[model samples]
Target chain A: MAEHDSGGWTLERTIPSETAIGSELVSGLLAAMQEYAWPAAELFHVQLAYEEAIVNAIRHGNEFAADKTVQVRLSCTADEVRIEIADMGPGFDPDSLPDPRAEDRLEVPGGRGVMLIHELMSEVTYHPPGNRVTMIKRRPPSP
Target chain B: MAGFERLVVVDKEDISVVRFVDRKIIDASEIEQLGAELLSLVDIQQRKRLLLNFEGVEFLSSAALNKLITLHTRVKRAGGTVRICNLHPQIREVFAITRLDRMFEIASSESAGLAMF
Candidate 1:
């Protein structure tokens, strides 16, 4: 894990595909988000989105194999925070995934994670080979 | 008396209430254990009314939420009712965004949750 705050705030962390590490990583990201003065609601949304992405990378992309690594990057600008997660295993097509909110899909446990991420994040994009997902959260407009 | 690191299950007026102790993330381990415990509430103990109190919980992954869905399904299959209460606002928004709000009976407080059953 690398945390750099000299001129700009950045964090780059790499973890093996171990489910046990999921919470600790989420805590780290959330702590940074708080320190960056993220609004409480937006912070929570980012937290939710990031957790879904990281867990998906660890569980589905890497198949929970300890040999595989999931790389995460957190970078911040004045108005936005961006997160990128990449895993070692072959990835799946997000488009082909079922909608979790669909009446028939409600009972199925598999698709909600991605749905939550897409709903919470402002900009969500998947990279080539579908192994990495990037999410951006722009600060909400002033009330 | 299988104790969970993240949940405290207490009986109240014949209601099985599960309060999450973990303030932050409810990961896969917690979710797996929670799922098994909830299943037993119906499979072994034959509980008919349940309430999951999310008072202290701030952030939970889809894994944990999925487990809750499983618990809801099992309790329903057993002809029991599972109601949730005290969701932190953000978590409540998650339920709304994912449209899980329609699937489970949710209340703003414990008393209201218990009253549902």
Candidate 2:
């Protein structure tokens, strides 16, 4: 819990595309959330959204290039957890992606991450050229 | 049988039952491994029905769902069927939100899921 001072911390790192950093970042973020003292269910939601963000940045955004770098920013505060991951690839129109929820696309295995990100997080906005995403999850009220 | 560290398998009659062993989040390679094991059960062993039991699983990533979709396609081609049961609440919500619930036959219990096949 003493990973940082009582004050919140903000960090930025250019993630190596070769590294699949979702699990690690989520674990670290969960650890970092100790100060906020979120409930288990709320914490799980944050973890899921963070996983999708990091995966999208590394997988689709950077195309898993060893040399390409994915920029990651993590900020933890008492009220919310915010993350931004940007990749160095040609951005695609999010609208062009097929909706996984559509009956025709249900048989297919993709198009879920973005939807999950938006649903799990309190706020999710794509940055133009569409290569970067900012996601936020507000801490649940104390019971 | 011991299925790589994250998965457990039990043969019950004609049903090939697969269970996850822990609460940890499964990554991509592990997902592929699970998919391969399922494919072997359906393809090599000619098992026509699969029951994926998730009572022990604490979380299911999109990667894990992808594995299920892959298995579904493979089994469907062989005239076999894949059914899932005991999905964790969050996982169940994921399947629902993604509308995968509409395509995959999901049941509440292992017996119910197995009966579907």
By TM-score, the best candidate is 1
Candidate 1 runs further than 4 Å off: A1-7, B1-5
Best by DockQ: 1
Clashing pairs in 2: none
lDDT (10s digit) by residue, model 1, range B1-117: 355566678999789898877786556776787777767778887988889999988878788788788888888888888889999998898889878899898999998998988
Ten contiguous residues minimizing lDDT sum, candidate 2 chain B: B1-10
**Pairs with backbone N, CA or C atoms under 3 Å apart (clashes), candidate 1:** none
Error of 2 at A100 (Å): 0.8
Provide the clash count, candidate 1.
0
* Interface RMSD for candidate 1 relative to the native interface: 1.5
lDDT of 2 by residue, A37-137 (tens): 76667777887887777777778888888889888778787888888888898876777777787767777877788888888899988878899888888
CA deviation > 4 Å runs, candidate 2: A1-3, A141-143, B1-6, B115-117
lDDT of 2 by residue, B47-95 (tens): 7788889896777678777778888998999998888998888788887
Q: Candidate 2 overall Cα lDDT vs. reference? A: 0.77
Ten-residue stretch with the least lDDT total in model 2 chain A? A1-10
